[model samples]
Target: LVTIVAVNQTGGDIPLSQLYAPNSKIPASGSANLTDYNRVEEILGDTSDLGRGATLEYHPDPNLLVAKTKDAPSATLDCSVGVVAGGTSDIPIAEEARIIAAESGLDVVRAYDVGVAGLHRLFPPLKEMILRDVDLLIVVAGMEGALPSVVKGLIDVPVIGVPTSVGYGYRGGESALIAMLNSCVPGLLVTNIDNGFGAAAAAYAICSRMMKKREE
Candidate 1:
């Protein structure tokens, strides 16, 4: 149900243009370029006898249609910020974080439910943010609260840690909050338990300050 039109970019004869005829890797014979031949028309001609559809439609190459390019913005008025969460329980936290971060003109990039137990899923998004030179990072973790510390150690950016109430117990999130506050990571900022919005606000403030300094 689809018709494909391809121009020979190799400066050679159309590879499979002649359907009924033998196909060859022949060189461009004359000055008649690949554009001079209509592949879609040739294909339609072969199936013309089976005629059901009355309309003939022509579509240009999609890449050509989308050829417009853009330059990166000159100012950090809308600064880039990264938000990551350790497990599925922290997804709502990440969303809250995203909303708060946006209030401070930060464009939030989320990596939700990146499993800390596996560690492999965690690294790629973190590596990407490092490559992008993100203004700040917000890490949300529940249970033992180890993920934020791990993330803080790996990246050069300032990290704000949010401890969520994911586990079951009398203490529950309190334990995670205590763990995060007492983290060995030298410069990690810890928020109260289940306080993703606070963590995001903290990161946003840092980013806003950095952006202002750049303007100065």
Candidate 2:
């Protein structure tokens, strides 16, 4: 919720949206372009409110831009975050969010390879996650972006949806983003395309508030 950075896709027909796309020996590198720099400049243009929103970082090898939100939560409450990936291709972003949640001192429980391709696969691990009683669940998906809504319907915990750039002709998460945005499930939280960090940040903020209320 702090900063916004805009960047354009490089390809014409099948864009190299994600570095880990199928048959995508496409992206040569993850270099930041002028537009990226300019976007950063625009976000950092005014330092009116400092250290409140987010911090931006770039991954060089695969060339990803990530913004992580940080804040320390209470040590007393045994806070935990559950992260689920719709498919194997979405693991990197899921792991990134999990790492951030762990760094913020929340125990992270993860289940992978449970995408909506097979509905039967999601239940066992999902039951385990719910049994653990996590403070929040961060669901990462691409394609039709149906995982988050499914998770939300099954659980009462806060659900954060991350739409990755994994679908065909979805334009690097466009379809997934739209799916998440249009989700009829009430109270389902969502992040931008491939934005795992934002989900983690939102998770941290929510968990912290809950912990504070518990203390109060």
Candidate 3:
């Protein structure tokens, strides 16, 4: 299994043990670090994944870790991922997903500034993705987060919605998250706010399964 680490903003172990009781959500995201040998060791003695055949990789951005097994997906696999950014501000997150998916051996293509305000701009790149037969679409959008649902309506493939912290008002990206969660589209999947990493990881899993089916 590949493991991804979400580093603490300040760069150290998250205070999960200290804050877990008060904030239930923190544990869900932070507790996974328990397997990180350098940080936590009590739970798993040989927590160093290298010995267990797990490899480690880091994101170009400092706050995240990625697992890239270059040989996992064969070069011949037909699966690819399409990434779309609803606006310029969303590109960094989209890039994160693209980099992770590419490193994990999935062919990745992109479309940018295709927000719903300019619906016409979305079609060309989308057409390219469809022509390439992309296995999944990672749509990163903010401000109402309608792009994912819109793209899902247009394409038959599954969509992964990444809500970024780009809007105003109550809690960070919660509005977008709510909008995505409320989508009527059946195959649209929603990741957490600013979680491009999660979206990529999910895309990798799907592509890996596709590759496996092809081999069989």
What C-alpha RMSD separates each model from the true structure? Answer: 19.1, 12.8, 9.7
What residue runs in model 3 are displaced by over 4 Å at the alpha carbon? 1-76
What does candidate 1's lDDT look like per residue over 1-216, in tens digits?
A: 121222122322222222121111112221111111234455335433323322232223211110001221112235688999888877776766765454334677889778577899988898888888887788888888888889988987778888888755127688778878898888888888766646755775666566668779
lDDT of 1 at 115: 55
Q: Order the candidates by TM-score, highest first — what do you get?
A: 3, 2, 1
In model 2, what lDDT does residue 45 have?
Answer: 64
After superposition, candidate 1 runs with Cα above 4 Å error: 1-78
* C-alpha TM-scores of all predictions: 0.62, 0.66, 0.68
Candidate 3 structure quality by residue, lDDT tens digits, 27-65: 222222211223222212332442323334434332333
Clashing pairs in 2: 30-63, 86-115
Looking at candidate 3, what is the lDDT of residue 8? 33
The numbered model that scores best in lDDT is: 3
Best prediction by TM-score: 3
